[model samples]
Target: MAHHWYRNTTSGNSLQESLDELTQSQQITPQLALQALLQFDKAVNSLLAQRVRNRVNFRQSYGSLTTYRIGDNVWTFVPNDVEFSKVTALIKVDKVKIAACDDENTGSNAKE
Candidate 1:
């Protein structure tokens, strides 16, 4: 089974909660709710792939990497005392987490 990464995000979680409520209220069947969530995943992934065009790159400096992990082609980094620099802004923070996923294994079901 492919991992539906978006389902763990805030919006996805909200949708799932709403579906659960609908299922509990007998407004929708369990199977239909499941299908709806699956479609949500597909639609969101497809839209992001097609609509999002601009890419921003940033470098983190003056930071110490507190934690690093790699699993399922996903790279996670947690840094402390970091300064992130973009094109026009520089932001400093005490800590931040960054997650990166490889495109081929993003588990998106969108077919071009």
Candidate 2:
């Protein structure tokens, strides 16, 4: 439950909008709404970790590693002449950015 990437995006916006409505109607206090949203974030993180089964692997061949970065335990790579494959399908691109995160390092179980 460490990363709430969707909290500021589409999925989280709906909950925030609903909370705003409830707050304006006086059915829930602002503090309560905030707590609810925070709980929603945690719930979403756990649910995705536990329920999502889809996975994709990419294999790339590049002339040289253009750039690489590691921050917050996530690795980002920008390579030139990249090719990505999932199963038997292959895609080629001039330049691509790849970002990877290890769930174990983040204290989450992505395969559970």
Candidate 3:
């Protein structure tokens, strides 16, 4: 499935929930739970960074940025921009999907 804006944060929340469950169940000490949650957060951030790299790389195959599924919206990401590292965290601003997909010089006139 394609990655969305809420995935990593949801994952972090789930991690904390699991830690709470473990601590309440007496399976782990509170101190250990805290350490585990911190470790999990670090790992998630690293994984998210790798995912961002993969998305940037995969974006090269498609010459035109006319692919998205949130109400049939389209997104265009600028490759090699340091700002793009935060792609997964930012809200979708490119929501215009034109009828024509064969041309790269099309206008983003459609709005959801």
Candidate 4:
């Protein structure tokens, strides 16, 4: 189980700037690992009967994780593998383009 900073309903494109700031300041990974179990899988059928719980409780000291989503909050899917984990992901959340600045203050002048 994993928690990603779901910035928007359609896509996570708009979260590039904030995510980068967070990644740098917090020194945390930008990628989030997601997992899904088949509803028909017999190995965990009993536990899957309830939708209330799917992941472990958020432990603040472990990782900066949350189950909340921003904006309209709708479910979407992306395909991948079953052998993934959050601890191993390294997503690049920063946008590739350089910003054209006018009176831009990047906190470079902040007093030390």
Q: Per-model C-alpha lDDT, please?
A: 0.75, 0.73, 0.47, 0.30
lDDT of 1: 0.75
Q: For candidate 2, give the lDDT of residue 109.
A: 31
- Write out the backbone clash pairs for model 2: none
Q: Give the Å error, residue 14, model 2.
A: 1.7
Which regions of candidate 3 deviate over 4 angstroms? 1-8, 54-112
**TM-score between candidate 4 and the true structure:** 0.17
Q: What is the lDDT of residue 36 in candidate 2?
A: 95
Off by over 4 Å in 4: 1-13, 33-112
lDDT per residue as tens, model 2, 1-112: 3444567888798889999999999999999998998788678768876988766555557477899987765667888887767676778888878766557436543321
Per-residue lDDT over 1-112 for candidate 4, one digit per residue giving the tens place of the 0 to 100 score: 2122232323343345545666778755555211112221222334333543433221233232223322222223222221222455533321221111111123221110
- Winner on lDDT between 1 and 2 is 1
Candidate 1 wrong stretches, greater than 4 Å = 1-14, 70-74, 101-112
Model 1 over residues 4-101: C-alpha lDDT tens digits? 67888999999999999999999999999989987897798788879977545445676688999877766788888877566687778898888766
Best of the candidates, lDDT: 1
Pairs with steric clashes in candidate 4: none
lDDT of 3 by residue, 1-112 (tens): 2223333577767877888899999999999988886676456546644775433212233244545334333433333212222446532332332231221124333211
